[model samples]
Target: MNDHSTNKPIDESWVAHLRDLSTGVEPPTSANPHAMSRVAIRRTRTRRAVLTTGGGVLTVAAVAGAAFAIGSPTTSGPLLPGAPTSASADPSMSAEERRAREVEAAAVRALESGNVPAGWHVNVLEGLVYALPPEIVTSGPVQDEPGVTSDMWHSSEDPDSPPFLRMAYVTPDYEFYDTKASGLTQTPGPDARSFDLPGASVATVDDSAPLSEIAGAPEADPDRGLVKILVHREDGPGRYMITMNLGTADPEFVEGFLTTLTLS
Candidate 1:
């Protein structure tokens, strides 16, 4: 019997088989151990792939972080929404400021992906994007324990004009209009009419409640009146309430405003 264990070199045939199985590429002609290892590494990387998608853009993040999108001409740019266009971060910028800028950029990318029209103002509050028309100005994402409120108004020369909309994006654990310490009344009565809107599964409109009872506004117009619309998010556990003041028009105007909204 032949004793092969003492002073035996690695079997060359076994190494060649492993190299062929792991990576199907011809080895270098100058097949030193180091050169063969390099060839295997290179071939393995070239054959590997990872795929991801965002906002209808399919991206393949491959070797050295190079990405390419499908159905589009190849140009090397980050296809993911909210991906930083520039890698360099300012040394003086605080973490909060950087986060704010990142969120803003992400919202902009989202709006573009949604094809929101020009002349629209976007408000990002509590990670939700609210895109409004130029005619509709928004204010105060006033944060409290109950929820966050963002009031909308018609862009006018007169400051006395009553706000057209009051939005409340409630906390995840709470209802749209929770009867809590915020003192905000939950006023969408049983008589509220239900309707449909994109990105929302359930929507309701109630014109019966007084504006004062809706948001406790000092500028509530008793005669012109207002309408309350509550929307339930289609894909998630979230509810948002929008109280719209019907100035000179009907409830249809509110619906028209809602069509322009891009929520993500």
Candidate 2:
């Protein structure tokens, strides 16, 4: 994985290096009459200039604008003025959203009431496990590509808020293993089902950056566009997962939550 701290604009030279890596080409040699390497080098650099300044930078500008808007105090809560007085009166729910809410609520009740039916958790495989501490609940793979686990809790900072984590173990073969999501402009696939999830987005939940040239089985950084880790695969065997979506996106909190995961 590239350094998370790298702030460079990913210049033409870097892009050329990346391209050479992807296509299995060698750099130009003076003795070679054919300019194939030279041609490739030229084309990649030209494409870099055009793509970066013309479209990529502009798209980045728009996302920055949205981030600014979302950070404003007015957006912290409550609908904008003049939208409607009752706009605060319970927004309508999509069917999928309603179903998810019911499920989450049941989970909360089970945790609080201390009687989460065993059936609430599917026993996919024997080694899979979960545990809930005061701050978080976590469960994931006994091995790579473990099945998905989604769990949530009411937000501590805001009683009205609720957040959850969606955990999935990754093999080196998954596209999103170690990249930050570019942003959320890419449309969901054609068969995508919709839902109005109740709380914040947790950086990455099984996703990759918009144009990551990475192909199959890439490794990933847990903090790369990810609010919470899907799993700690590099922790090696017996790794499980926990996601913390119940509050503001804090990487520390997510790590703290991970500390509570247990194999039982």
Best by lDDT: 1
List TM-score per model, in order: 0.47, 0.23
Q: In order, what lDDT does every prediction score?
A: 0.59, 0.41
lDDT of candidate 1 over 94-209, digit per residue (tens): 87888788678857775676545566667664445556667666554445445454555554544456546666666565543545334333434676787656677776777653
- In candidate 1, the residue pairs with backbone N, CA or C atoms under 3 Å apart (3 or more residues apart, or in different chains) clash, namely none
> Which 10 consecutive residues of model 2 have the lowest summed lDDT?
195-204
Cα lDDT of model 2 overall? Answer: 0.41
Give the TM-score comparing model 1 with the true structure, all chains together. 0.47
* Backbone clash count for every predicted candidate, in the order shown: 0, 5
- Local error of candidate 1 at residue 173 (angstroms): 5.9
